[model samples]
Target: MSTQPAPASRPFSIMPPPPPPVPLPVRARSFALVGTFTASVFLSAFLLFLVQPMFGKMVLPLLGGSPAVWNTCMLFFQAALLGGYLYAHLSTQKLGVRAQVGLHVGLLAVTALLLPISVAGRSPEGSDAPIPWLLGTMLLTVGPPFFVLAGTGPLLQRWFAHSGHRNAADPYPLYAASNLGSMLSLFAYPALMEPRMRLAGQSAAWAMGFGALALLIAGAAAWVWRPVPPSAERADAVPADAPALSHSRTSVPWRERGIWTFLAFVPSAMLLALTTYITTDLSPVPLLWVLPLALYLLTFTLAFARRPPLPHEHMLWLQPPVLMVVVLLLLSGFVEEAVAAIPVHLAGLFVTGMVCHGELARRRPAVRHLTEFYLWISVGGVLGGIFNVLVAPVVFNNVYEYALSIGLACLARPWPQERRGWRGQAMMAVRTVAVTAALLYIGANSKDMNPGLLMASAAALMLLLTLALARTPLWLALCLGTVMMYSTVKAIREPGVLLAERSFYGRFKVVEFGIIERFHVLRHGSTLHGAQSLRNPRDPITYYLPHGPVGQIFAATAPRAGRRKVAVVGLGTGTTAAYARAGEEWTFYEIDPHVVRMATDRRYFTYLPDSPAKTRIELGDARLSLARASEPKYDMIVLDAFSSDAIPVHLLTREAMGTYLDRLAPGGVIAIHISNRYLDLEPVVAALVRERGLAARVSSGPDGKRKRYESIATWITVARTEEDLVIVAADRRWKPLTDRRVPPWTDDYSSLLSVFEW
Candidate 1:
């Protein structure tokens, strides 16, 4: 028998009886498969998020650096993401696995032609519909590529579930990886990429990354490719006792999908609402929008993680108190500083996101319905964006969407499955009504009371009510809704508020506030943009007061001869026109048409009409409009543009300085109003002036002891020669801007974080 066996094996002797083939360890193979899918998903998310701020920055100057640019971009992205998820769901359900992979790869290849990304068109000239224009521009510029990228996470994870891996039964952890990539990218762009690379370089690098991702995606497709059906592959790879697979055969109900949507909606809405609230009301830092988004993505990461750092129950426990604290902050005017407000608002958002997204994760469907699950979640995200960007601006004034989302999040919290009896429900209803009445009463009566005392009392009562109702999500939501309603009503009924309007740029309020003399104040968030005296209608008050830095700038820059021509970048209440002399020409460049309307409306302000000079308003982004201006025509160029309290960073960069120099008349001076409550812009201006080989003087205007109407201001005047700025330089109050050795901001690279007062 041995001789027979040896004779039979003699055919292999030439190959020396090749050693038995070694098989990879099961655990090693499983990890390798999981990592490939995870990394593909991660790269998809990283590229998706990196493009947001990079492209937003590219388009920021077109929109005058309005924080709304970022909001609108978020909306666009959400909508695109929805479209992508829809495609993923339909394709996966309707097509074979190979067909799905082929279609997606083809789409990716096509979208590659659109990169490196850019803003497609100049914002339509004098276009009144900035939101529509921005949406259109973004759609044309990056829509295809972004939509392709947005779908990669869901599609790849779905593929992974069918990939015949041991852990294929549960692929949700890959979603955590996806969002982790998003969070890291958002942080990296601002801290590393932005400071080091110009926008152009970032775009190019992003394009190359996309190419690598495409190859990796192909590799993933190859790894999962099978001649057998996906069902057969899963049957061969996974065990019968796999927990996730037990529910894989069940169909998700419409009701379950609706719950998934609602759970996703609150956090999605809160992301944009919180971003708008922070950048609009607190600080308009250059990359400020990234924080809300990163936190938003982080919640997704934690909620879906295999082993979350923060437990789901813990998040639920933390949510109510955080919401109550946020409500108190909203009612009270405390925490106005960005350093404090940012963390407070971000914490609220994080907790709310945790509760909502954690619920979504808990209720996540089996691997078979993964694509459908993502589709519904994306629907909620898009709806949230629409509510904040489209619906809120139309339905309610200010950022009530933020408060509304908070209430919705309250409702999304896990509720008792058992229904309460009629008596219990009635009692809960009565208690809610009583709480509502009390909150409304306190808010209505707040005007005459000491504001701090009133806010304290109301906040205390609301906190107590919320804590009591925390066990019942429905009742807690009702109480939170009541609190928000009271806050909104109080704001609407606030004393001296004449007109409150919202635009794509920001919220604008015209109010009459004065004891001895009435003044019409144009307010943007907490910042006083400009004010006009009803007693002396032609006088420039607020930041433009006769004794303020702006006033000093006007006095120093006035031409000695006839027919001086001037250009003002920002047209806030047209206040700079107050210094105009007869026979002079003044052109105002304003980004928001609403601002132009408010400034020209005699009922609110009269600076432009009352000016003795010939005044004309130019409606567009100042940078774009100035690029079209007649070179060297302006005797003086005044940069007074602001997006709420923060000046548009583009206006303070070296490139902007060069534009001003190009537009300057011989011996002309560039006067920049650098006043800000949150940023140290003097250093930024000093850097710009030094880079341009120009002389400059900076003035921190009169002290707080000055006239009530004279708001403290800071201004910097830059000139080609010292003689051009001699008048300002001679004044002790206006000191030469010594180089602070700060890096000069360029169009390609600028970080508000670098210049942030914090």
Candidate 2:
């Protein structure tokens, strides 16, 4: 009994001993391999997205700050991405693993030579085809580097799959990692990088990152390379759940590839269409461009995640309701304020993108066809960019492409797997027509009915129709299409619009308003650019009304010497020309040709023709046009470009201030119209002025209660010294800016967040 008790002695610890440590060599090798590939991919994507906004910012000064500039940049990026995907597909298909590694490593080294990207050439002067010019310039600037980086995602994942690792069977999670990098870069640019760093600093840092990425890529290549036969490697890499066909030998069906492309197209198009719609229809909030693109990249991360938190089925079920709410908001015109409209539209875009991209993840082909799958997806993205950038502007007068894309996204939603009988189809058709007809009735009688009641009725009908046709994608698409058509048509054909034109710059309309006074207004989006009295065309109205801040600026700066010369950066209806006096010379720099045409048409505006000064119009971006000017100096420079609310950031940087100072005559003043609904630009201008050791005075006009045509305005006048601004500084309404410091914006860096009103 004593011996038995001795045998039952307890162990020293409760826990079992740890298994033998992974062999140090094996552990280090594995860690190095996995870490190298992941870091390389992450760095590549980070560099890829960072270059977009960086290069876009550089290009904006050449082109005016039209939202189209971003859209055009997106087109170029997509096209380059497509080319990269094609290269990846072909190279992987034709070459062995070792050969692929050598080829890719060489590519990274070559692309490194083009590091620290910058715009290559000046925009052609007076070129009507800015799109081509922009695309060509970008091609020379960032194309090779972007193309190589774009291929890193698929290429690295393919390499990892053949590495003979335990987790090689399923390599899709790396795609989520890739997109994660992209999303972070987008957020970082606006939040951290732009606010803290200069453009030159950012570029240098990006170049350093590229160098590190090349080294990482070389490590990944060395880890994956093998002397074994290609067939043996492919056989070893085949996943247990994958089909028997070797990825190397198998050919994906064209129909499947097409399905992949169609799934990808809707979301890609929606990304741009929604961005344009938001910036065009709502407030052009600073850095708002990133929100849509960030959401766009986020969908890819979620869709390809190892375990998606929100399942594809959930997005499918959730999209219709969100889409219906967006339709209601658009139709009712209730959510006009940027605070409300922005979140609503952004949510809609996120949900819609999730559905499309989720479907893409679900349908992704075997590892063997990975590059091909990405190639088709890239094709879809390029097509989307082309549609929105090139085709939509010519085909539709308004932002009709945005609505069209929404309808198309509805069609892209998963249809019922079970075929519908004729009775089911007939029922769907009946419900669609009923909802569409009700919408039409509401639109037709909108003026006669109380807006709230009409909106309520339309919302109820749309909700009912959405639920009724939830299982039928085609009918749901048709109903939404009808709603969009009617709503947009009504908005476009408002009673007062005499002329409506669309260009890459923006939508422009000459709207007749004020029955008693009879005025024609030049409107861009929701902001009034300039307006003229039909009875007295030479009288400035709206933001430039006599007695307003701008009027005060002109009065204060009126020439006391012989033949003063004036330069106007933006020529909205040429309203500032009304301030010109006899023997004075005026030059107007206008970016949009359409605006120039309307301003000079005498029928719509006579401010320039009626002015007594020797006035001339120059068509181009203001900064570039001004740089090319032969004039030695300008007595007064007026900045009137901010009224449309898309503040051309390039025009407000410290370098821009230097340009203005260079062109300014001794004792000359610079007048900037800073009246804005969303941005407190006086602070920005003040910061710039103080940075240059200049004096500035700000005029905040009264509420214009005395005249219907006059509008409340704000203008800031800057000069080399306080004495130069004495004329405005003496007025009670014009306050001298304090020397309090805020971060000054330079050519390398600017943050809309710094000056955002809210």
Candidate 3:
């Protein structure tokens, strides 16, 4: 061999030197790949959330700013998100990776074409189908864009799994990042976007951001497409007999999918129901809306995090007691206290969401099945949303969805899946039947019993159930049912349903009760809007009492020349119509068609029918309808447009005041009902009138023991000058409102936080 090599005497090596060790091609740095996918997920989330509130605000004027408008919007978003997740799941599983990338990129590009979102087709004008119209309008406006946006997180994560990044094995942490983006965007909408920019400006800026997200997503896809070494590719292939990494390749059991869906459903439904509860019972201020949603997103952020600070077991254990308190508060009317109730409801929502979302995170499958997991979650969200916004309203009379959601949340606990022995199972069945019978009995007999005693008894039973039957799924379900029965029992026990109506506005329960059961009351949420003593239908009761500010306003304007034209904003039982004299022109501007119907129905409320004045009801937002009314000016304009306990924020803004003034005749007085359990609206009205260079007086209704129909009312009376409100000005009982430290609310801005009464 040596001689041969010598003979050859060629080049450098004796014996064939090892072929030049093939230099391995350097891999593109993985840091950029991971960051690119995360950033893409974040941006997509931000744009999606920013567009939600932006578009919701843009359409608010058309829908009269009802909380129901937000509810309907949430439903549409959930449905769209479900579609997006489904698309992601299908594309990832059914299509090749390259096709998935191409399809998603194409979708994003097409969605961009519909950017700078605006409502298409005029808002439903004079149509009774506001919900249908809302759904249709939202479907046309942001539907495609949102669907595309919704797919971004799951789709990008799926791509990241195959991108060969160091952390590609688990993509769950990326979900936390996505929710963080959503939380930031949600916070920014009210604080940064809405306050500083108009809808058009917000939309344009959002479109620009969306375009940026598209580029990041494309970058992520490119990273996924980068070529890999043959060894790495071979290593990635699992042997046919190799065990899956935590069940990565195994088909997700139907039961596991069901658990994911049920867990996801609880949180989504609770989010909507809690929003409605807070906004409806406290104030439908943007602050209230943002708070609940912020908390909701926070749960997702925490649950899907890389290292969850709170364990799923901890959340599961913490939820039941909090949930019990929540159901009790809801049933016992403890939520009437906004200060106490708001926090209680929020706490309940947080704990419940944490348990549900945390379990979802715990049970999350490997990156291989990431898209499917997300798809099931989205499905659950959509179903929950539909139940709240559609099914509940259609099937039940009250906001029973809220109570039902609590029950569902309790059942969502991750308990033992395997059944106990027949004896144990049989015992659980017997307990379940016993609990059911008890619930039915409670539902039937809770009426006429002491609330304190009933609540005590229910609490005791819940404790017993949790102790004896907590380990069994059937028993857990029974416990949930028992809680629901407790809530429903209270509603059913309440006397007299003149009209149990649901509308885009909210639930209206026209209940009857009092000495000899002579009074018919209009209640929305837990607040009483009006009450009419069947014996005294014409005598204004509650806030409309003869000696109250509302009464004084009407009495002062009673002697006006020509027809005493009176325009009232909120129709709440049409009690203001009772102030109308014979032959006077009375027009009611009502946003809720149900309220109009309730007020006009002689059997329900006779204030509209018993009015001495000729009455005409205009159906639409009061502000919009007032703008369109080119009528003879009214001597007295009553802005009693509060819904239950919520202020129609749109109606109280400075622009809204100007509208009222424009419709007012010379020397006409504008009376605003400012009485609220949770807000000191006197300052708001004071600041507004002061800005307008008008004289304002606030009358605080009697503070002594309230009569059966009488409540403590606060009214702000603003007039062109002191001369117009001579009677109110002269009366010492009506104090002058001099506090103008707070800024007046405008169409662009209002701070419920600033004026929030503790």
Pick the lDDT winner: 1
Which has the better lDDT: candidate 1, or candidate 2?
A: 1
Give the alpha carbon lDDT tens digit for every residue of 1-758 in model 3: 01111121111122223212112233566788778888998888988888877777777777667667877787788878888888888887788677888888898888888877887457677646689888888887789999999988998887766665545556778999999999899778766776566567778898889888888988998986776554332112221211222344446678778888898888888888778777665554436667777888899999888788886566665666566566556655655457776887889899888978877776676555788889998888888778778787778776677777887876777556455898987887887677556545554455556889887867775665555555554466666667577667776776566678777667778877866649888778667788888987888888888887777777676677347888888888888877777778988888777787778888878988977778898877788778777887988888888765656777888778888888999988888888876677878888887788999888888666776878778888889988988987888888888584787777656656566676
Q: After superposition, how far is residue 713 of candidate 3 from its true place, in Å?
A: 2.3
Give residue 430's lDDT in candidate 3 (0 to 100): 80
Find the candidate with the highest TM-score and give its number.
Answer: 2
- Candidates sorted on lDDT, descending: 1, 2, 3
Judged by whole-model lDDT over C-alpha atoms, candidate 3 comes out at: 0.75
Residue-pair clashes per prediction, in order, are 0, 1, 0
lDDT of 1 by residue, 45-103 (tens): 99998898888888877765665677778778888988999899999879877789999
Better of 1 and 3 by TM-score: 1
- The residue pairs that clash in candidate 3, if any, are none
* Candidate 2 residue lDDT tens string, 347-465: 88889889988777755655677788788988888888888888888887788788888898888876664677999789888988987777667655655788689768766865776
